[model samples]
Target: MSQTTIALTYDNLVNRIVPGPQSLSYFVPLVVLPIAFSIPPWIASKQTLCAVALPIISASLVHAWTVMGGIDVISFDMLLHSYHLLLFNDPRRHFRRILAKTATAEKTRTPKVGSRDGKDESTTPQYIEQPYPAKWSGRLPWIGTLLISMRFVDWKIGSPSHDSKQPDRNPTAPSHLRFILTAILRTLSGYVVLDLTSAWTQQDPYFKTFGVSVDSPLPQYALSGLLPPRLIRCTIMALQVWASVGQQFQLPCTLPVALHWMGYLPDAWSPHLWPTFFGSFRATFTTPNLGAVRNFWGRYWHQTLRYYCSGSGVWLANLMRLPRRSQSRYLLISATTFFFSGIVHIGLVPPEPIFALKSANQIRWLILVFFWLQPVGFAFETAVSVVLHHIGTPRLIYTILNILWFTAWCCFVLPFLGEAGRNLGYWRVWPVPVSLWQGITLGKWLAWV
Candidate 1:
């Protein structure tokens, strides 16, 4: 492998930064925008729309710096660009002979299936198989649904006489109006959870209705004496768990219906019988167990990058000549997935650009430790399983211990990231319908908080 090096300089770092030009600091961090969104300013001020723009711009720049390097920026090694993940889908071939044959077949006016020199030949190739879901009738609707989702239209054009094996939506909505109404209610409920959580993070005295402060040492934090940090820290942990439930169950997964009602289309992202823009979360984070650590991340977790983190290893291992059957290879690939998880989570942590720590922020580093080290803990539990099974431990005992192991493991790691970045005093605008959240129950709820 070839190594390259480059020298760093102040010019690119906004030169004279050694002494730090005073006015440049102010200008560099700030952004100003003026807009007229085809609406009268007297009816709704431009400031209302602009409220979300600044923080969004700041977050985008900072997150881009962490994920994609340019200028003096550096992204992590585990980073996988959206298109880079598609490289694996392109097809993998080892033998040069097969590669040449496949290339030649694609170049010519040829049928996908034919004969070459009395031998059965296929453009499909001996090594890699074509994507199955694209060809599966049962799953083909998803592609149409995704395309429709962009425009916010329902997939009413193609009606399948039979639904593929998929569950029906609970609290079945018979009409589009009812579906949208339910989505609005769910969205409001989610915002309430988020608002209460934000208040809790700030340790606002007004958060008393939640009863989190009443039972714990949290009251001491804003009080006169030295605050027990654990009270708030632990409180953050509870807040994160609560927030996850809100996030998973909330209108986020169902709001596409509302968009349809508002003149956008709802894509049939869901199957025919259970049509949805995004599906249910019931299976994603269900009752936890030790063995479920594998299932939780593997089957339950939705793939933002289409399972690239886990499946990319099969491609990488082939390229690296790692034996497929070796336990060591599997463990290495599994740990590498955790590295990918660390990369994604670290991007979510507040960059704290204003802080600009010389040693870098310890909080983010600690939070990353929780993600990067999770596979090791999981690996430990896997070893425990092997030993227990080898010793012929009873299935009942194994199941009980597995649940305890998963619970203890998550409790140990969940708090680090939970308290680190969000505990800061910066207020954020959560995406919610303010019109709904500002009325009736929401008004009372906000007052309570």
Candidate 2:
């Protein structure tokens, strides 16, 4: 065979032998669900899906509450756009691929000192020398480990080569801009539809509550109350945008930075302006009790679905129509996706005081619960697999593990934390009514409403 053909064959062989870096990077996070399942029965008894689901469900309810209160549709648009941007902009993948290539190069460059140089440097028997520098240990720093692991995976998976011979091309513009614009337009349209639908649906209730005629404009009492609704809606949208952005980028993964920003933003603005902006935006979106609930649901559904669909490679591949065979592949992929979801949740963590508030406290608790549950849950799964003969229900097992893990954490772990429990509240409030709006949108439009 020609040199080129031989090289190509070798490359293909190497690619087939090595797993993708993206896949390997996911291993750390994906183990969380299995860890949850591995918990002891006594601990498992304390876990209930409702504990995990309720806070999330409540948060969704509050998001709708704010929307119904009257936040501008644009605010929601901006928030979603930010999230999409962060999701696609992760640089870790590229960084890993680079490291992997460098390693491969270094390995190939090992020196045969005596033979190559035409000098006998050593009289002793020839032995393979270590490729790494003597001054440096083979052990990598934690961060270095992550980067190197990522690179190894990338190279093995046939990532594009970065050799100098490959001429650089002008980088392509991000497709995210188009997605952002589309999301904005879609969100705006949905907002309009929501308003119109609410108007018609709310006619009877408005008449009954305010003792006013349905054919005419809102009565004075209702008009007076409208401003608060609008303000609440804007607040919800802003929070959703902020939370979603943080989650997508894994910004909150740096806990200290996230806390600083959360505390800083609210304090930086003029108190009056903050409330006014929030109120006006909320009014624009049309917030009220029920409307707020609907908006909360909408944002919840949006975040949850987005996290599940795109946050992990496995889920993204499946959602985007990539093929997978065998139950193990599916389990592996789902675990990876779930791990990413946890990272997103970590990004959403709030400061101590903010977490102490009732709603935020619940979310904070949920986050902590999941954090501890990840490893323990996986260990539990390994133990169970040893005894169980069937492995046909990996997905079901994962789900059960999550449910049990959260339940145990909430009941046994949380109560012991004392004041730590106080840290469970939300920094932002979303009204419960948004859930209704979300349901209507999904049922009728077959899309996130």
Candidate 3:
């Protein structure tokens, strides 16, 4: 050890994360306050509204981040809105722009008011007002607007709907019964995935082990001079991270839709508004190719953060006067997006002595490096795939080779993520309310027997 003594403890780290009970109050307002204020500007129907609204929103967001701890999900979410607001500067893009009134066939445009002489006295545009807004239809009260504006991830125009194959060009709104059923199923699936992963994690010695310093041995990751063990450990680490992140994003994402069903919020608030939210994360397995890695990040992953993460890069690229859709611009956006992702996640790392980290900066460095390497890997994967195709590799053999290469790539880089995650106490939190796996393993199930 480098004789640099850092004064920190495990309990200090744990204390920094606000407990679940205390977090709800902070969480609600962190999400709601911004949307509440945003509605007026949204109603004003001015894109410039975000200009005035964003600074205030950004201040509150920064204040919340400073005060809060361990509520990464919504915290990152609010920041995305702030970035979108700052960069896009369009209130309509941030929130769904609904009509003041629902339009019937007659009220689709301006309506004519006739005097007793049957001549039009006044003709003013009228929109239909509805109890519930349809999928493609518009018209909602201010309250309905508030509900719709609160959403962070699903894009009004580009987002995929209930059927991933179908874009929003012809949207289909599921029936209330079907929508609720889907929400319930998704909620249950998320819970089971989380609970199972938590149970396995609690049993895994990887989470139990920690090093005294960054240089100290971390047996969980096979820090010793060993290859096979390191590969095994890294592979397991990747799977655990994948499962944990999937459920974490899935659980919170389903809540708004479920509430929509319960509160009878609005048809505009229905799954038709965001079908992808119901299944935001797609299955990871795909035919191994250049698109495999791209698809994993772009399609299979939960894209809640994609909008603002990429938007920050887009803003920067534009500021640099890069040509639109140029290779350099694409690379810059990709790098910036991953870099922002790293910055967002770095918030999870507390002061040192949390885990193996000697100083918080050590973990921070690892976090940034881990994310920064992603674009490098993506570019390399694309180049290699092209070379393989040019060399006349058989499709089946090429795919198999790509799978191995990707798995090996994951094994190489995922240890950085595993290390950062551990230092941040990621594996410590058990999000599930009740522990069925604990009950089973501990024989608490005997009571039911």
lDDT of 3 by residue, 41-117 (tens): 33544445455545566666556555544334456666675656544444333434433333443445444443222
Clashes of 3: 4
Task: Report, for every candidate in turn, its global Cα lDDT versus the true structure.
Answer: 0.41, 0.32, 0.54
| lDDT for residue 58 in candidate 3, whole number 0-100 | 62
TM-score of 3: 0.63
lDDT, model 2: 0.32
Q: Which TM-score value belongs to model 1?
A: 0.49
Q: Write model 1 residue lDDT over 100-146, tens digit each, in one string.
A: 11333454545533232234433433222122132346233433332
Residue 161 CA error for candidate 2 (Å)? 14
Off by over 4 Å in 1: 1-79, 91-189, 204-289, 320-329, 349-361, 392-396, 422-449
**Candidate 3: where are CA atoms >4 Å away?**
1-15, 18-80, 92-204, 211-228, 248-263, 278-288, 319-325, 351-357, 392-394, 426-433, 445-449
For residues 305-420, what per-residue lDDT tens digits would candidate 2 score against the true structure?
Answer: 33333334543554566555544544444455445444444333332122233343354456555434443444454455444425443544544543443344333332222223
TM-score of each: 0.49, 0.23, 0.63
Question: In model 2, which range of ten residues has the least summed lDDT?
Answer: 270-279
| Ten-residue region with minimum lDDT total, candidate 1 | 91-100
Clash count, one per candidate: 5, 75, 4
